[model samples]
Structure formats: structure tokens, C-alpha cells
Target: MSVLNETYTLSNGVTIPKVGFGTWQIPNGDAAYDAVTTALKTGYTHIDTAYAYGNEESVGKAIKDSGIERDKVFVTSKLPGEIKDAEEARRHFVETLANLGTDYLDLYLIHAPWPWNRIGTRHDEGNLEVWKVLEEQYRAGRIRAIGVSNFDVHDLTNILDNAEVKPMVNQIQYYVGFTEPTIVDFSQKNGMLIEAYSPLATGDLLHNSQVQGMAAKYGVSVAQVALRFCLDNGVLPLPKATSEAHIVTNAELNFTIDPEDQEALRHLSDSAPEHFHNSTQG
Candidate 1:
């Protein structure tokens, strides 16, 4: 069986595939449809999209046309960053459900604690309000799991202090050189999973000499090394791929990284040239 068949159980007992296909920066219509279809055909069971990605409708169409049973494929979408009120969140949730053509989502997340352009703005009360709506929908069975992306400890603590249900996952910018040990530990200790987005650092890490050296040593693609690093460290990785070969290669994680190599990867500093901030610039 493909390694895609492997899974990680969430806090609430929902089973999420260990490797997920990410749909960030993928335009809607044919591009999104084709990319998603390729991933599904290549054996990826988890699909991560967001309202911010502007491709949920196309992602949904591809999934519907693939003839895969809905239950077998775990679908995830996120609320827009701008939605900070309970009513607005409910409205967007329904719209997302309609756009995806799914009655329920396997997972849904608050795209960010603050709006994209205003990353550090205080939104604790606003997030709490929106989380209330998510809690309501989750209880009504409209979503199987609910979470937050880009949330640090303060943001996560706000929800934990006031909400009835705690977040099941915290999706963030995580990879071999950019791992946030503090957040990872906090999430795991509190029964939440950390879903690593940009596992390739948006393609910058692929060219790092250190990463390339490790990949060459292991006889795997640099992408595989980065992703396997996350899995070995107990974080789920969501790697975006648009090509069929890459989609297939991203899931072939049957090898292990030596303990010492894993430690070196874990200790790679955020100040390193290949870190997330340096590579994400336009």
C-alpha cells in the first residue's frame, strides 16, 4: 500500500492522512481541477484547500468527478482571515460547504488569527467569537474537526480559555529548518496535532546545500527528506505539488532518517538562509 494510507489520529479521534496535498496558489477552474485530480489519482487521500486559496469549487469538482467515495477522501477547508464575527463565520461556512458541494467537511480551520495584511493585529476577542460558530457547527455535525492556522500560543490560548471545544490541529509554516519546537510541544501536550504547511518552504529548501546533502545521502528527493523529517518528528506535513510525478514522489516515504541527521534538521536555525521568511518574498 502507498504510504498515503498511513494516518494520524486527531484529538477527537478523527483520522487524518499522514501526508496531505496542499492547494495554495493554485488558480481555480482547470488548473485546480487538474492538480487535484492528479493528486487523487496518484493516491493522496487528504486534500487541504482554503477559502483564501480561491479554488475550493474547482477542488470540489475534481473530487466529485474522480469517482472516489467521499468518506475515503478527507477534505479540509479554511475560513477567510477577515471573518471575525460569529454570524460572518456562519455565513462563510455555509458558502464554503456550497462551493465545495459537500454537506460536511472533514476538517475546517480559521485561516489565520489576524487578517493576512495585518498579521500582528490583536484579534483575541474576534477569534473567540468566530470559534463559537465553529463549535456550533461541529456539534451539529457540519464539520468533523475544527482548527486554526498561523496560531501561536497566545492565539491558541484565547480559544482554549473560552471555548467549549479545543482546537484539534494548528496548521503553520513548518519544515525541516523552520520547526517551532515550542508550539509543537504545546499542541501535542494538549492533544492537538500540528499540520506543517509549506513543508518545502515554498520551494526554497529544495536548493539548500544542507538539505540537498541529506537527500543525496538518503537517495530520496529533497522534498521527501523534508517531509519525512516532519513525520519522524510527529508533525503532519501538507506539501503542495502540481505534477503527477511529484505528487507520487511526495507520498513515497518508506525510509527513515538517522537519529543524528534528524537532530541536525531539528536544530536548523530560523536565521538560516533557507528559513520560511527569506523564501516567501515575492
Candidate 2:
């Protein structure tokens, strides 16, 4: 069977596709619509988007147009991080459902512990308030699973300590060089799955000689090597692609990296741009 057919069960017993298509830079309208349609047709069952991405409407349209059953596709969206109040979180959740033209999302996430512009400013009390709203939504069946993105250990602990529902996943920048092991370990230990975004390090990993060597050894694209590395380590990789070839190639994960190579890939130094830290560190 194709790897795209595989799944990982969350702590809540919700099954999510192992590989997901991320709609981050893809804008709304025809561009986002076409990209998501192409991904669904190419065998991607999981689609990741955020309100911050400004493309949920197009993403929803493509899924509706694909002629696929809604239950077969896992749709994920994130609440805007600026929402620190329960009422605002509830309002945005409804808007997101309307934007996606869906009554319930497969997964909903707090985009970040802090607002995008206020990275590193730990807003524990505010995040807990937003998380409480998420818990209410989840209990109401508006979301199948609840999670957080770009959250660090401190941020996650704050929620875990006070949340009625623990986060099921923590999406972060996990790649060959930039694997935040401390956070990854904490999430896993606490029964939260680590969803890896930018598994290819946003195309920077392709240039790394070590990554290239592994790709050559496995006879796969560097993108494939990077993604498979995440999968092998039990991380769900969300690789973004607008092209059909790249989207199709990303889900082709039948090859496995040798154990020795996996260790090397894990310890590889961070090659991500400086701005990535500024944007992702929460």
C-alpha cells in the first residue's frame, strides 16, 4: 500500500494521515484552490492550513470539488495566535468553520503560544484562556482534535498544567538540522504527537552535503530523504508544495534510512535561517 494510506492515531483516538499537505504560502482564490485540488488528486488525504494563511476558503473549495468523501480527508486549521481571550477564540473558530465551509475540523490548533509578532513573550495565562475555549469546542464536536503549533516546553507545560483537554499534537520545525529535541521529547513523553513542519528546512536542507549524501544513498530526492527521516523518527511531516510533481513525490515514502544514517540526520546542526528562529520560537 502507498505510504499516503497510512495513519497515526492521536491520544484522543483520532486517526490522522501520516503525511500532510501544508498550505502556508499558497494564497487564497484560484492559486490555493488549484494547489489543494492537485494534492487531493495526488493522494494526500491530510490538508494543513491556518487562518493566518488567508487561504481556508480556497482550501475548502478544492476539497469540496474533489468529489472525495469529506470523512476521508483530514482537514486541519489553526486559530490566529493573537487571540488570547476565550470569546475571541470562539469567534475565530466559528469564522474558520465558515471559511472552510465545514461544521467540524479534523484538528484545530493555537497557531502559536504567543502572537506572531511577539515571539518569546510567554503569555501563559492568555494561552490557557484560549485553550479553555478549544476544550469547549472539542467537547461540542466542533473539532475532532485540539493542538498547538510553534509552542515550546514552557508554553506546552502551561497548557498541560491547566487544560481540561491536553494538546494532541505540537507542530514545529523539525528537519535534519533543526530538530528541537527538547520540545520533541517533552511532547512525546506527555502523549502529544510532534508534527513536523518544514521537514526539508524550507528548501535549505537540500543544499546540505550530508542530506544530499543520504538522498544519493537512498536513491531518492533530498526532499524525500528529509521527509522519510521525520517519518522514521515517528514525526508527522507536513511538507508544503504547490506543484503536482512535488506533492506526489513527497508522499512517496517507501524507502527507509539506515539506522546509522538516522542518527547522523538527528544530530545534524541547525541550518535554518536566523529569521526562522525569530518567527517560530515561542
Candidate 3:
């Protein structure tokens, strides 16, 4: 039996499980399939993957193998940064749906603000076209909600300015460290739900004094402290795990940090250790 459970409601009234299994580095093989199966058996209902990850097919297979109904789980996939134009974006959507073997996506995100390759060479202009295309999909009921990832306040504002349908979610790299205060507040003020990836600071804060102290005080792991910070701060956190222990441990984050502890954690963000995003890690 699984014990980890937390949830948040998106701007579109969709209730998303706050804690999810992020398949960022889980390779598409027996290990990947086993990891996902373990995560679901351990009570994870949210699965986050991307076309760039090249494992959506395996993820779909894993879910189907688990005997879990499609609607019982919340799956999120992203558009590869290279396909940023309307036509390519439309093709990307169709491909992702086919790969995942799902008719409708619970949530779909524009993978990143930084476009890749030379497909559509107009920078953010391609993103706008992609957004409109996704909007059309949402209106057609192929995608339940549309959102963006790695977008700053400027990118979000630009979309809002020209979009016929407002984005319901913004998936960003947020943790107690690297809070991105302006973007966080701006999204909240505009009624957009912020889904946090790398919310554990990619494991950088697992042994920090603040988090460790809170963990010792609360009798939980330091990761739980960091996860509690994100959840309590109103950011929906999706921490990745390839093992069942981590999947369960990451979900066992329903603890609390008092006001003083929360403040200390916030202050520690300034002294955040190096490689905050783990960009250097292989």
C-alpha cells in the first residue's frame, strides 16, 4: 500500500496530485518501466514526461501494464523546444498523443522558453504560434489544459497579452533555493498555478543545515523538509525518482515547518549551494 498523497487544483479546476513521478532521466528500458510501475504501485498518480525524453512510449506502456485506468492518473507531457511553430507544434501534439497512446492529455506544456534548432527561426514568435495551436487543441477537447515551462514573467505576460485562452499552469524550476520571487508572485497574482520541477533543488539541499535540522526536529528526511517548503509555499512540486524507495520517500512529505523554520529556510535560499540546478551533473 502507498502512503504519499497531496493535491492541488489547477486554474481550470483540474485537481492535480501535488507529488508526482518525474521521468527526467529514467531511461526507456526495463529499468524505466519497472520504476514507473513501482511508482504507480506505490501510489503515484501523476506522471511527468516530455517528448525530448524519448520515453513517452514506455511511460504509456507502463501505465497500461499497471492496469490503472487512464482517467485515474494525471499525465503531463511537453512540446519539444525545437518544434515551436504552429504546424510543427500541431504535429508534435499528434505524435505525443500517439506515443503516449492517450486520446486526451490531462495537461500539456510548452517545454521551454528557449527554442531549439532552426525549425521556426523567430524566437518567441514561434512560441506564440505554438500556444495558439495548443489552444485550438484544448478547445477541441484533445488537451484538457494548456501551460508553459521555464517561462519568466515576460514570457508569460507576452502570451497573456496575445492569447485567446489563458494558460492554466506554469511549470518552473522552483525550490526553497532559487525561488524566482518575481515570477512566482506574478503567476500567483494572475491566477496561474505554478508547478515546480526540481523542487528538491535536484537533491542539492538534501543535507543543508536548515533542511537537515528541520528533518531532525520533525523526524523526517531533509528532502521532506524541502518538499514541505514548496507545498506550503503554494508551489506544486513534482520531484523525480527512479526507485520505489525514493518514490515513496518523496511522497512522504506531508509535514510542516513553522513560521520561524520557514523563515530560516527562506533565508538559506540566498546562501544556496553551488550548481543549484545541477546543470553540471551528468
> What TM-score, over all chains together, does every model reach?
0.96, 0.97, 0.92
RMSD of 3: 3.4
* All models, RMSD in angstroms: 2.4, 1.4, 3.4
Stretches of model 1 off by over 4 angstroms after superposition: 270-282
Off by over 4 Å in 2: 273-275, 278-282
Residue 266 in model 1: shift from native, Å?
A: 1.1
What 10-residue stretch in candidate 1 is worst by lDDT?
A: 273-282
The predicted structure with the larger TM-score, 1 or 3, is 1
C-alpha lDDT of residue 134 in model 2: 90
Q: For candidate 1, write residues 163-247 as lDDT tens digits.
A: 9999999998888767777777777787899999999888878878888898999999999999999899888999998988888
Q: Is candidate 2 or candidate 3 better by lDDT?
A: 2
Model 2 TM-score on a 0 to 1 scale: 0.97
Steric overlap count per candidate: 0, 0, 0
**Candidate closer to the true structure by lDDT (higher is better), 1 or 2:** 2
Candidate 3 per-residue lDDT, tens place, 76-135, comes to 999987776788888989999999989999999998766544322335687798899989
Off by over 4 Å in 3: 1-5, 116-122, 270-272, 276-282
Question: lDDT per prediction?
Answer: 0.89, 0.90, 0.80
Please provide, for model 2 over 115-211, each residue's C-alpha lDDT reduced to its tens digit, 9 standing for 90 to 100: 8777778899999999999999999998999999989888999999988899999999888777788899999999999999988777777787777
TM-score, candidate 1, is 0.96
Best by lDDT: 2
